[model samples]
Target: MKATPITLLVCALGGEGGGVLTEWLVEAARLAGFPAQATSIPGVAQRTGATTYYIELFPVLQSQLCGRQPVFSLSPVPGALDALVSSELLETARQIGNGMTSPERTRVLTSSARLLTTQERMQMSDGRRDPAELLKLVRAFSREHQVFDMNAVARECGTVVSAVLLGAIAGSGLFPIERRFYEEAVRGGVPHEKANASAQASLRGFAKAFEIVSQRQTQADFVSQVLKAQAMDSRLRGNDAGADGNDGRATALSVIPAEAGIHGFPPPVREFASLGYVRLADYQGRSYADLYTRRLRQVLDAETAADPQAANGHAITRETARWLALWMAFDDIVRVADLKSRASRHDRVLREVKAGEDDLVKVFDHFKPGVPEFAALLPSSLAQKLVAWDRRRIAAGKEPWAMPLKIGTHTAAGMLALRTLAAMKALRPRGSRFAFEQKMIERWLDGVVQGTKRGWALGHEVAHCGRLIKGYGATNERGKDNLLHVLDHLAVLPETEAATHAIAEARAAALADDAGQALDATLVRHGAPKREPKPQPIRFMRRPVPRESMDERRA
Candidate 1:
């Protein structure tokens, strides 16, 4: 017999073992030799709290050819579910609206409404609706509905209702798994025999209920069987088509947005799609050049779309094109042997100078002669040295005057030096000169990293640090206020030094306060130390009598 595809949705409160039920089905399907895929939204509201889980299963036939198959989420296609097993009634209603179930092809096994409602909580703080009312709603949507007091069954069996619900889903006769699959699942999940016994009892009860429903001809077995078969055949064909290279397989692209921890600017849609999900893991370790190229491609695409007078008439704007070309050319020169190192060395020197080191002047003097005349014109101490040298030459009658030169600020020079170091690091691989050049071009295409007008920059350490400090305040009111005082004092110190000294001060203050409080408590418990006056020192007056005796003897 041909196999069928079945989608089973298990919905419950996030902490109420919904995930456990889904896992049981997955294991059962696997043991039954059925092909299956499961996806879930595991938490509430992105990152807030708890969330629901959704599972879908597909049974494969023995006669089918083996090949790759597409994995789909719960809501991949509409009206594709064969069974809807919900832990709560409201969730059943939600699944129906989300296209997770079809009235003609789905079997719904749900608990009656014992869970608290939003309105009940708002009004009474402990309101609950009749379980029978919830069952009525399920019956209205499902042609084959089985309502059981699984909560009571669970209590009698000495277990929770979740395992009982899983047993009920197994007994629904939707999956091709054997009885042992459910038994083993219960054994693995519940651990205790009493819980397993509860699940078995629930299964037996659901089986009896299903038998009565089946006898009435109320079950839409024929429709469900047909749909399941059609779904299986489609999967088999899709696998075969993918194997034959006639139909493209579903590409799983994982997008790591710029905001998602990546350091570079956001790339254009086309470039973003090119890298796809394959290189997502490489985002962290990628070379600056590679990141730049990827970003440049995006910018170029955007510029091309917005421009009007290119060779393609709609190609990149002339200004952007020129800028990109100039950047690439500069990148080529910058990639020369030791250029990156030279630049890094320059940056290091500047950093040392900023930190109050005066030796950087010596390093600057060594590289000054080779540096461009434009770079020679700076307010740096080295520039002063160059001016002095020119004046000396003119006095010696070798030169008439100093030549005009342009230079960069200490910060700009430092940036240039860092870029050089990055370039040198890229050149370590042999036979990669051209590749390095291409990467340089790409990096140049991406714009410079700069702070915003308000001095806030995306992904800046200071910005994140500020946010952390603010969040600490919101975390706890009184404790945070004390900490804030310490932080304020620390902020006045240098950024580099504040972290260590401020932390030490805050800790010392807290410890001292704790010690003083402990002492006060000790005094309150055992009484204060006995009061006593300190003795005064005696004063000597024999000096005056000795001097008078010496004066009388002299007279």
Candidate 2:
């Protein structure tokens, strides 16, 4: 039988136990009496940004033939790898880009998308591809490809997904090692009983799945033998040529062209010039090569400028931009700084944005005027409370503002407007408040109408105004029982409902504190929900039977 090297490319995130998986494969090969090497490139968030482990194993004649050296370089030839295993979908896609697998020879086992790069989650132009869609594409490329929700399976097995994924790969039957080698490898450093059980489960699961593809080895062996024969024949031909006579070698030599008839240059130079080459010295330091390089650069630049995906160097589309923008807007409205920080926290997000993570739409939403306008009308006491709340958020790795809370920016302007409106409302008489409200609304409407032409919208502008009004009204009545609870639910209501709730909360608080019964007259005029009577606690009594006992004893 001809010997064939089995190469396995194990792809995963940096912290996803890729090293443990590599170790398991190495130990399994050793136990099976195969020569094996395992090498890894630890991802550093710069190049590819995902850890990749490579393993190669071949049958060895004896234990003495095995060496300690690890295979650190990738195989150069195509159709050489036997298996590709990935802990994440994007990592598998990366291996495809590197030409590590072919439809005929390689088997792929990958987990569906459980771990997503920050870019995939928030910044990619085309947005994240569905894990199922990616798996379908891989399956189309190779019939041996398989995908599973390893994360779900891990949860079911009460272990991590990485181990589950590795188990599945081992179960594929591409390797020569028994399941015990993999089990023992996983058991290292873990409690003996638990490790043994987990390893056993992994081995069983892999063995069950491995039987499906075991029949293809006959074809692989045939191909291996053909390649070995060709290699041997080539070596024999080289030896035969080396043993030939001088005359036999001399007859193979070709004539060189004379310079005199070749434009005062060597025949090779003349031929190259005719084909398009130019002599830099004769051409005044300019040549076709220089011109070609410049033109190539220009084409690249133009292509990058025209194609947004090219500019980003990955698939990012206009639809993705719109989705990210909306998500940013949602984060702003909800005051969810954690989501914003996490949205672009990784290199993937930076790569997808091209301009850096800070430039991503989700991160950009915080800096917009609409977000801070609502933030500004919040009472100083409430603002202080929120600031404390935000400090905790920042400590928990959140970005507190949709944008930085610096003064003199558009965000500040919105805040100033909301504060001004709040002050105006507080100073106006209850009866004349509508006139003030109409004036403030006109000012807000004017800003919206002007900003809309500049690509801003009424939804963002009105949300800002509504948030300010609601926060101000809620903070003022926080001492009232059930008022904050009602306001909490009210804040998430439809815009119209929010407005109604804001007006109703303000009216109730005003009536409860009114000294001249003016609020009663106002409530009668406005038709608000009437306050219910407070419930009184019930009292209980006990019987006095002990006094009768004392009287009987005296008798």
Candidate 3:
């Protein structure tokens, strides 16, 4: 309805230069002898902020009318938007979902790469959002749209992404301004040669987007063909015929890794085995990696014998592949030391902090290791003695003791200390905590094996319960308790409800809350009793008698 003012709505994550991009557009419009205004609402970094910038430009042919001026709104009118530029695929769809863009009017410019929302990444299971859904909405909303990997374009030019977005706006050609105005806006204060590289990347992004728009119809047809092919492939592979989703046995068997020593097994088994081997190898050493392979081999043998036809695509091995690898490479003090001491970790830290070539960087690691962490390294008898001492201290109105270590990992001696501790991975199996975790893993694996003999669905549920036993220290202990409780309590239920849905419901409940309240509610729903609250205790503190004054002692 407001034809005189061209409106653009930009939706971007924090630090992708949304405000800078808006500034560039405003400058370009003004440079071309047009009246323009831009404003932005600040947003939080990553996924959770309200960062939207709005711009309105009114074309003025001449400066003849001194008294006349144009009015522009600070925010975009939802259905009247002329352009929508988004840094992410989902955000593009989100704006459209909000009815900000009309199919008949707006041109959509978006990057297809995903940084994934925090919510998507934090799920207890595979939490990635599907890209396919966004692609469909991209087509439905924009009258003329261009989608490409803008991040790659920016990287190629060795510059930030604001220039690339500016280039995209110029290429859209909705405005009558020459490209040089946009280029001048960038290269004004900077040198021509240095600025041209940025200008070129911006222009390249613009041209790429324009081409996509021109050939969009053909692109849509190709997408349709790809979709049909995928559907046919899924049918042939029997991906959707069962409850395991697109992860069918045949498909899993078809994507075997080319890694050595796993060729004897089928594709699915080889895939997971290779991953477990690599993970454990990195977490510990070649010997431990071999141990993981041997365990996987046992599961593979059982799976092959029990389900020779490979129903559920050797789902048992698939589940073991994930949980077993995670369980075997449990986090510990030794593992922390190993990670921190690695040269690769040092290099990564340097890169993250963006240290200069001549800058001297010092890194200090702070650790407050209490009795438990210390006990993991000592012999059982020594560990018990140390724990008893801490208990005695606590009983005498003192806090449980901890040795706070300010490890200067930046210094030669500090780095060496950590590296020595890292080298103790060979002695890890003898540690009390390691032995305890290994026993727990063995029990979980046994449950999986038993579930498989009873039913694949039940086995799958049990294997998935490995998600319950995660994290280090207290969290790990709580997860272990939940897993064992479920196994013990649910084993009594009939195979039908317990295996098919109740187990999954219980697992969901466990993940729903950190305090185990949701898990208790779920357990109660499934005929298990609610957990009783622990009894509270109060103790009186006795202060030490003050020493008598010198004068009083003399008297």
For all predicted structures, in order, the TM-scores are: 0.34, 0.38, 0.75
lDDT of 2 by residue, 149-262 (tens): 665565444455567766676666667667666666666646546656556555444444344334344555676798678668859776643354533323555454332222
In the predicted model 3, the residue pairs found to clash are 249-313
Q: How well does candidate 3 score on lDDT at residue 495? A: 59
What lDDT, from 0 to 1, does candidate 1 have? 0.47
Better of 1 and 2 by TM-score: 2
Name the regions of candidate 1 deviating beyond 4 angstroms: 1-4, 43-50, 61-64, 67-71, 74-78, 124-133, 189-555
lDDT (Cα, tens digit) per residue for candidate 1, span 1-555: 434456666666655566766777778776677777777766553213225556666667323537656355655355766777765666666667677666787778876535555555443112455555656667766757776555555544444556767667666667777867766665565644556444555455434433443443334567677767866887977754335564533678866454332233323333333343224223213353354345444544554443323233322222232233332233222333234335565665555343323333433222222222222224345555665676566556553343432333235575465455445433333323334334443332332111111111211211112211111112322333333333343333344343344434343443344223432333223323311223333444344567779899999
RMSD of each: 31.3, 27.4, 8.1
Better of 1 and 3 by TM-score: 3
